[model samples]
Every structure is written in structure tokens, then in C-alpha cells.
Target: MYEIIFNLHSFLAYIVLAILGIALINAILGLTGKKDFTLEKDFRISLFALILSHLQLLVGLVLYFVSARGFSAIQEFGMGGLTSAARLLAVEHPFINILALVFITIGWSKHKNLMEASRKFKTIAIFYGIGLLLILSRLPWSQWF
Candidate 1:
């Protein structure tokens, strides 16, 4: 069960990263080009990114409970005994990821209220960009490669 959930969480991370990257690029282009925020493309891209990220959050939560490097490490080590690697997986990764999701969610909600294309693009660009950066900062890059 642990292995399965871990694998699923790892696999879903790719999807979440890819979608967020594409969404960020799209938002940048929309903002720079001053393009209209069309429902067909912009909306779909943002919505897809949002949904995939939420799914990843759910999977990550499950993995946190079941993975050895997650809750168990913290429970056993109390906090200080956790090696850098263990700390990354057990605490930093999850915490930063949750924060990224918060930024993404705020971006999505804010864009909906904006009537101007520039404002919508700006909201998504700023919020999603920050979220993407946060996720990148804490990813287990060594393990991933």
C-alpha cells in the first residue's frame, strides 16, 4: 500500500508540474501580449492546472500518512533527528506544496472576478508564478532525478 501510494504520488507530480508550467507560460503570454482571456483556452488551461494540482494535494496527503519518509520519520525522530533528506520529504515538501496550492486557488478565484483582460492575466500571472516558484523550491530534486 505504501509503495503504491508513493508511486502514484510521484507519477501525479509530473502531471501537476507540467500543467502548472504550461499554465504559467500561457498566463505570461496572455499578460504580455495583452490578449483576451478567452473561455475556451485560457479558462480551460487554468482550470486544468487547478484541478490537477488539487488531485496531487490529495494524493500527497495520502502518501504523507503511509510513506516511511513522511509521518513516520517525524513521529520517530521528533524533529531534530530528521536528516536533511528526511526533513525535505516529511516537512518542507508538504508544507510548501500546500502553500503553492493556496496561491493557485487564490489565482483561480481572483481571475473569475475580473472583467478586464489585463487584470485577469495579472492576477493569474502573479499568483500562479509565485505558486510555481514555491513548488520548484522544495521539490526533491535529487530523488526525482
Candidate 2:
């Protein structure tokens, strides 16, 4: 069960990151060009990115609870006792990812409330770009790739 969830989470991370990147790029282009926020493409891309990210967050939360390198590591080694690698997995990754999701969610909500196309694009670009950076920063690169 743990392995399945772990693999799923890993696989989904790639998809989520790709979609998020596309969405961010699209948003930036729309903002810079002052393009109309079309429902067909613009809305769909942002919505897809938002949904995928939320799903990834859910799977990650489950993995955190079940994986030995996650909460178990923190339990086994007290906060201060954990090595840098251990701390990254047991603390930094999960916490920062959660915060990243919050930013994405906020961006989605804020974009919806606004009537201006430029503002909507700007909000998504800024928020999702930050979230993407946060996720990239805390990824366990040694273990993952």
C-alpha cells in the first residue's frame, strides 16, 4: 500500500509539475500581451493545474503519514537529531509543499473574484509561479532523481 501510494505520488508529481508549468507560462503570456482570458483555453489550463495540484497534495499527505522517511523519521529521530537529508524529507518537503498549495489555491480564488483579464492572468502567474518554485526547491532530488 505504501509503495503503491509512493509510486503514484511520484508519477503524479511529474504530471502536476508539467501542467503547472504550462499554466504559469500561459498566464504570463496572457498578462504580458494583454490577451483576453478565454474560457476555452485559459480557464481550462488554470483549472486543470489547480485540480492536479490538489490531487497531488492529497496523495502527498497520505504518503507523509505512511512512508518511513516522512513522519516516522521525525518520530524516530527527534527534530534536532535528524540529519539534513532526513530533515528535508521529514519536515521541509511536506511543509513547504502544503504552503505552496495554499498559495495556488489563493491565486485561483483571487483570479475568480476579479473581472479584469490582465489581473486574473497576473494573479495566476505570480501565485502559481511561486508555488512551482517552492515545490522545485524542496524536492528530494537525491532520492527522486
Error of 2 at 16 (Å): 0.7
Model 2 TM-score, 2 decimals: 0.97
* Per-residue lDDT over 14-113 for candidate 1, one digit per residue giving the tens place of the 0 to 100 score: 9898999999999999999989999999999999999999999999999998888899999998899999999999999999999999999999999999
Candidate 2 per-residue C-alpha lDDT over 1-145 given as tens digits, one digit per residue, 9 for 90 to 100: 9989999999999999999999999999999999999999999999999999999999999999999888988889789988999899899999999999999999999999999999999999999999999999999999776
Cα deviation in Å at residue 50, candidate 2? 0.8
Clashing pairs in 1: none
Q: Quote each prediction's TM-score.
A: 0.97, 0.97
